[model samples]
Structures are given as C-alpha cells and as structure tokens.
Target: MRIPVKHPWTLPKRLLGTFVILASIGRIQSEQKSSKQPNIVVIVADDLGWNDVSFHGADQIPTPNIDALAYNGVILNRHYVLPTCTPSRTAFFTGRYPIRTGMQGKPLSVGEPRGIPLNVRLLPEHLRNLGYRTRLVGKWHVGYYTNEHTPTRRGFESFYGHYSGYISYFNYTISKNNHTGFDLHQDTASTLEMRRNSNYATDVFTEEAVKVIENHDATEPLYLHLAHPAPHSSEAKEVVEVRNMSEVNSRFGYIENINRRKFAGMMMALDQSVGRIVKALGDANMLDNSIIVFMADNGAQTEGFLENYGSNYPLRGLKFTHYDGGVRGVACIYSPLIKNNSRVSEQLLHVTDWLPTFYSLAGGDVNDLGDIDGLDQWSAISLAENSARESLLINIDDAVNLRGVVSGKFKLIEGAADLYGNYYGDTGNNNSYPEYNITEILESDAGLAITSIGNSLLTETKILNLRSASIVRCNNFTDFANCSDTCLFNLQNDPCETTDVSADYPEIFISLSKMIEIFESELVPQTNTDVDPASYPEKFNGFWMPWVASDSSTIIATSSLIGLINILLHIFSLIFFS
Candidate 1:
C-alpha cells in the first residue's frame, strides 16, 4: 500500500490505460456487429397449409420456389403459431403471447376499436431503433380503428397493404358485417390506382417488395415484412384470384377439388412472388447479407372461416382449433449466416419468438424486450443449438375457455372437443409424390439466387434428406377418433394427435393443466367490442381507414402554425448570418 501511494500518478495512468483498452475493445466489437447486420426479410404466407409446399411431401401442389428455399435453408418442422391470423401476427409483432394483449380470440373484425396496444413497442419500432428501415406490404390485420393503430404509426416507414383481416386479390375489397369496401392503402391513403389497375394482390405485393429492395440505400439495414394475401380466401370465402387462370388450369389440372385448384393457382402466384423476391435481393446485391424468413401465418382454413381450400393434410384440426393442424405452420429460414443448412430442425419454436430473435440478430439485447413470452432463439436457429424454449403456451382463449400448452413432447388441450380435433390425411405417399425437375427450378432466376447464397447445389440426396426428415407420417395412428375436452397426446409418438393420453399420463397431464392455470391467472381480458358504425369505410372515401379521426382539423391548424413559425425562424437566422 505504501509503495502504491508513493507512485500514485503511475497507478492512475495504469487504470486509465486499462479503461481505454476496454473501451477500444467494446468499440471494435460494436463496429464488427454493425458491419454484420443482415437485411431481414420476413415473408408471411396467409393461410398456407402444412401439406401445401412440395418439400413437405404434397403432390397436389408444387411450390418450386418455396421448395428451393426450404431445401437450401433449415426447415422448421415443429414451428408453432397461434391458431389464426391476428393472434399469430400479434405474437409475431409484439413478442408477447396473444393472451397478454387480449388478442387470443378471433381475428380482428373491420371496425373493432382495439389493436395491439400502442404502449407496447412493436418489432419494427425496435428494429428502427437499431437503424433498420422497416416496411410492410400485404395484410395488416392487427388494428386500424384509430390513426395511431396503422402500420405507419406503429413503426413501419411505409405501409402498402390492407387494414382489414382479408381482402380480394384483384379488387382489393374487404367485407364484414354486411359492409364491403376497398381495403388497399398506401400508408393511410387509399391506393385507388391499384384498385383501378386491379392487380393481383400477390403480384402487386411482390412488385412493391422488389421496388423496396431495389430503391433501398443498402448501407442501411432493411426489415421488409412481406405479408401476402394470397391463398387466404377473400372475405367471401369463395374467390381465389390469380394472375393467370389458364396457367392455373394447366399447372394444377390434377387437383380434383375446384376450390383447392384455385387455391393452388393462388399459391403458384405466391411461390412465384417468392422467386421474384429472391431474385430482387440478388439483383440488389443483398442476398449474401440477408435473412429471408418464409412462414405461413397459421395453418390453413381448409373448411372454417375464410376457407382458402388449403390443406393441412396429415395433421389434426384446422385454423381455429387447438390441434397441430391449426397452429403448426409451414416455416423456414434461409440465410448465408445459418451455420446449419439443408436440414430439418425438430426444435420447438413459436410465432412469438420472432420479435426477440430478430432483435437479437439485429445486434440488440433480448433483455431489452423484457419479460415477453418470446425467447431469443437466434443462436438456436442459426447454429443448430438447442432451443431456449422449454414449453409453448399455444394459446389461452378465455373468451372461449380454450387453453393449450406443449411441454417436452406432450401437448394438452382443454375446451377443444367440439372443434375440428380430427386427424386429416392426403392420399399422396410422403415417400412417393410427383417429382419436379430440380435442375429446372434450381436454375431459375430465384433458384440460382437462393442457391448461390445458401447451401451450394440442391442435389437429389439433399432434397431426399430434407423431405425424409420433414415428412409427417400418420400411417400408424390415422385419426383422433373421439377426443375428450381435456385430451392429452404425446406429440412425439403421435404427431397427428391420434390418441388421447390424458388418462394414461395423469402426472404429465396434471402438470400441464397446472401450467395452464398459472397462465390463465395472467390472462388479459379479451377486448372484443362490437363494430363501431362510425368506422364504416363509407364515411371515409370507401376505404377501410382509421375512422376514429383524432381531431385532424386541430392537428392541421397546429401544423400550419408550426410551419409559419419555422419559416419566420429561418428568415431571422438568414438575416443574422448575413
């Protein structure tokens, strides 16, 4: 101690040097992270089915572009989502369980005066804070009752999509409560030009996405949320609009069901859209530094509300039920950064994970997201590490008294007996489905782009391995013959949820039941309000818009006064400087 006191200046200098070295290391790390920030592109397919993409062993449909990406990327075999669109999207955007936001019920109707609460920051907002340019194209069914609820207000710099749950592909019309109106908009303003042009929504969204990529300042990271309206039937639940009917008829002639045939065509456009998006990224020189996440918002609506004629064949239940078919989605991630490629990941994941996952990937701390249901799964996803998730709160719909939870390999569901809790299967064998020319698809503009940046060549063996690993076979257990209200199933043994194991595994069932009770205690009351007539699109130029109005005239007056003051200040500055 006496020796150090005799050399006080030297000790202080040593401490200062240490501090500088630490700061330098931190700065270097920050710079390295900043340089490695990948452009994030999340492509969400609306109402796509589990057995829809060819990679998932479906012969009825050929998603070549989608398959190319899946084969080149990691297929998320056990990716789970909420049962329907809004709830799934809410989880994706908010990083919280829908139950926390009181959005665990049905999709938001046209005029509900509620949305993902504004106080809670959204994914785009967090990304924007980290210097990413965020844009949204396609469906924005989260909320739009107030001016503050739209995408642009929430964080998206540009919003080119519909505000309602679903809209017509060509006409951009949405109908609800016997009121039909235009639903397309370009950041709060009705995209009347698009309506007049009558472009297919998928094609339109693709073009806009391409434009966003092409026109982007590449120095800045991009977060493009391409939420397609394809395959999600229009509100009419009968219309399936595609760019070319002749091509649809020729390409999907083998499909027996007419509705499914239309859906196939719709999916064709969506697949092509994916191709073009990949091509655009390549053209823009962003593919090598990009992460493309392709996922269906939820399982298909094969026969329920907004029935798109999509099939979740070989899985139990459809969109609104608690079964795997309802929540298990078709999802995959393609990126040059993924250390694990051309494989199937059995690790359990949920829709809510995207927020923290993407945020972490963008070099932000997941802890900043704070107490959300989502776990930072970036490492688990990219490095093939085990997922941080131990369990999934599939949903807790208090309004319907339905609750579901998945822990380990067992899943428990209560209040879903009357729902479509039956296993469904397609006749096509997983081992033997109609094969496409891999060379032809892999050589296409999109295929080449995706393959160049992803796992080298898409060989037959790789394709076979991907298919073999991802194929869900329900040969042994064909159906959930009679599921009780509180049914439990070992999903690992019976992925299709064929047998109710609640009585057999009483301990596991009771443990999951208790977990559900704990979640139920934290349930936020569902804010299901009746349609506010004032929000009718008829009042605001035939577009589904923010009808709450929010004192526009007062805002305009204040803005004008502020502009006048700014001009005066500028004049004064000029005089003073001169």
Candidate 2:
C-alpha cells in the first residue's frame, strides 16, 4: 500500500512556506523544555582513591562504566577536595570553603549540633529556585543534628538514605561510641520495616536513584545527587562490606589483602550503580538533555580507623592528611553540551567551585550567590578555557595546628602531616584492562556523544592519551628526610610531596604561607558541640533522629506510642510465659 502524502503542488508556495515555519516553531517549542534547563545528575563516591578507578591507570579492579564516563567526558586532573567527607561536602553544597562556615573541623559526629550554617544557602536550594526538582540519595554526612539540617529541609524535595556518615550495607545501622542505631530513612521517617533482605546500601541507593530518574517529570528539570556509600567503610566493627563474595574471589583474586579485595567488590558495585543510573536516564529519553558529574567526595582512607584498603598509589599521604593523595580526587563531567570531551583537563578546580559552576550551568546569575568562595568555572570546564581559579586554600584548622595552601604550582603545608605521608599501593599499572570499550557500553549512552565529537570512538589510543594526561607519575624524590612543620613542594614537579622545597624556594613559600594567613582571617570558629544524650537513638525507638529542633515533636510522639506498645507486649509476655 502506498502511503498518502500532502502533494507540494496542492498548496500555494507561500502557504507551504507558512506550514514549514509553523512546523519549525512547533519543533522549537518541543525542544525548549530540555534546552532551557538540562537535568543535573551528580554522583558522588565516598572515600574513593585517586588510583582506584581504571581510568587513573589502576588495573587490579576494572571500573568500566566509570572509565567509559570519563573517556566520554573531561577527566579533571587537578580537582581538589577537602581531606575528609564533611568538609568536602560542605564546599560542594555551599560553594564556599568550610572555613567560612566553621565546618573546617572534622566530620560531624553523632548528635553534633554543627551543620553547614543555617544562614549559608546550598546548591540544591539555588537549583530549586531555578525550578529544578532536587532529590538526594545515599549519604547526608554534612549534618543532621536538627530537622532543619536534614536533606529535605536543606533544599532537597525528597530524601531516601541514611542521616549519618556511614551505615551497614544490609541492615542500615550505624555504630558510634558503643551505641547502635538505625540510620536509614525516607524523608524524615525511619525505613526500618522497609529494609529488604540482602539489599546492599549501594544497590539500594542505585535503585532509588533510577526510580527518581524514571519517575521524574520531563518538563521540570531534575537535580538528583546520588551519593553512594560504597567504598566508604561502615561504622560497624567490620568496616568494609562486600555483598558478592563469589565475584570478589573470582575477579580480584590477584589482590592478596582481604580488605583490598572487599574494596574492589565495593567499587564493582558502585560502577554497576553508575551504569544503571545512566541506563535509566537513556531509558527515560533524558540522556541528550542531561549532564552527569561523577566525583569522589575525598581521597581514600588507605590504612586507618574505618579503612576500606583503597589505594592512592603514587600520590603520598592518606585520607586525613593534606596531600594530593587525600585532596586530589577522581572527577569528570559528561554531557552533550560540553564542547570539550574525551580529554584530560589539568585546570585547578576546587570542590567549592561546583556551587557557582552548577548554578551558572543551570542559567542562573552568579551575582545572586554573593561573596562565595566558589568561583564559577562552567566555561572553563565545558569550553576547555583557562580556569577562573588561580589558587586553592587547601585547609586551615587552628585546633589541629594544620594549614595548607596552593598558589600556582607550589603548595605550602604546616603542622604534622608526615605520619601518613608515604607512597602506597604496589599495583600501579599491574594488570591493565583495556577490553571494556567505551563505544560498547550501551547502558551508559555516552558513545553517541563520543562519536558525535568528530567521530571519536574512545579508542585505545585516546584512552592512553587521556590516562597519560591525567595520571600523576611521581619522580620518587629521596631528598632531605626531614618532613616536619613548614613544608613546601612544587606539585607540578612533585605531585607526590616526597621532597620539601621550602628552604630552596623561600619567596614562594612565604607567598603561600601569606595566602593561608588571608584564608585564616575569614575562618569561623568551630561550633561543634558535645554529643547530646537527648539525641540518643534509644530515646527515639532505636533510630537516629533530631533532638533539639522544632520538628522533634513528631518523632517524639511516634516514639512514645511505640514505647507504650512495647511495654504492653512485655506485660503480656509475663502473663503468658511466666
């Protein structure tokens, strides 16, 4: 059967031109929704190492999905984050250094009243103002002392995850100071009964993220922050949790260390989660109009309390120290909008930059975010321009007597950082797995972007080019053994702070030290309070909850009702069994 068509000769030329104009206008209207505000998906991996991902030249455990994303995007070579989770998150959310908000201290402890200061606005709140539906899944470690500090109150429309730093993979429980409590929740309500058997935290978060993406309204832009807790150790005594023992044994048989093997499995789970989330976006037809940003919160805890045995490899120092290993994180940005893709960017980008950067990307005025430490670098990232950021105030904690600042290529450090400052991991380029082709990953839906950019298929040559451009190969300097206070190292020459060049370059040292002094002047005194016994989980029916906030009444009422039922059950047990 021949398909009937409107004959061109049937209408006048002017009328036909009018019809063409109308059709073009209709097409423009249909595409305007996505073109106006693209969906923003920021996936944060907790405590991931600099050398852990395969893109960074690690081969022991393959992260094909992550590598595919990186290869299709710009691999951030000099991306700097804080040395720990809480501070890093504070910077990312607020687009300001932690020092400005008194969040410069350690991670928010259990029952601590301190949070990203209530006065300081967050990224989600700004995105929300731009008519974006904001949702957070997985870790909310910045703060949860009060109802106002929680994700829902802090700009996210919905929250589905734990309130604390880390929780058990299966049970969703956190242990601190010999006290155990259920931390999993679905927007201020404890998800105790909703917990699925054998459902790991990483998998659960991934499912929730995919659901959010699938169910999201296409008209309204979505800002989904999927913060995965995998690779970050749980609060329990058995820190690392590996759901698939069989796969761990088979895939990571080369790794002799038990914790490292477990870490590899956790990474595998996270990589799978990344793949699934991207697939969900593609399945929903949101890929072309979406931007995916993947980054580790901070560096890995190589060997310490709550260590997952992650490797920073050639980079010196562990999670708590101010070294490239701890601060220089794994990061990338993948989107069709980006002109510069499938390359490594050596631009200096700080965690705080994301706030203004993302806001500008969402078509918001940077002036609205007044006096923020984060500089907008959307142009620098997307167009491969020189970064707006020239220097980075690494950190300053007077309590610990530690301070660090990076100016140009020179980095200045003071206080005791030598304890964990040593090269880690022997498996740098041991077993390179280049078999996971970026073009073959149909789930990620990044191949089209790669091929569209002048027929680049993310080939082996391009992968090597990207990896070589990003990976920091240290010179293994064996100079003056003294690594005490007031140390200086040129990060350009010594990416690993193996040698102290402070005495050699006095002017640069003085300049960076003065830079620290300037940042210190803006520091807010730490407001972290002692753990309030009233905030204990036992008081709230074995669940971590807000205590001193106005919204505590609802939880209190629920706890009272459950307590009454428990007492009634005890009385019945005495009457029956006794």
Q: TM-score winner among the candidates?
A: 1
For residues 216-281, write the lDDT of model 1, one tens digit per residue: 988778999999987788754456676787887888777666777788899888888999999999
Clashes per candidate (backbone, < 3 Å)? 1, 0
lDDT of 1 at 310: 80
Provide the RMSD of all predictions against the true structure, rounded to 1 decimal.
Answer: 10.2, 14.6
Worst 10 residues of 1 by lDDT: 1-10
**Candidate 2 Cα outliers beyond 4 Å, as residue runs:** 1-35, 196-198, 431-456, 477-481, 551-578
lDDT by residue (tens digit), candidate 2, 1-578: 00112254565798667656654554344345335788999999999998888788766677877887888888998999998889999999988888888888788887777787665668887776555799999999888877767888778999999878888998888766777788888998885586554588899999999999989987778999999987998865568888878888888777777888888899989988888887787778777778899999888888876788898877887887888888988899888778887888989999999888888877666886779889988888889999999999888877788889888788888884676777665454544433434344423434443343443456667877886787777775444335667789888888878788888999888888788888888888877677777888888888888877554445444433443343333334323433
Question: What TM-score does prediction 1 earn?
Answer: 0.88
TM-score of each: 0.88, 0.86
For model 2, what is the alpha-carbon lDDT of residue 202?
92
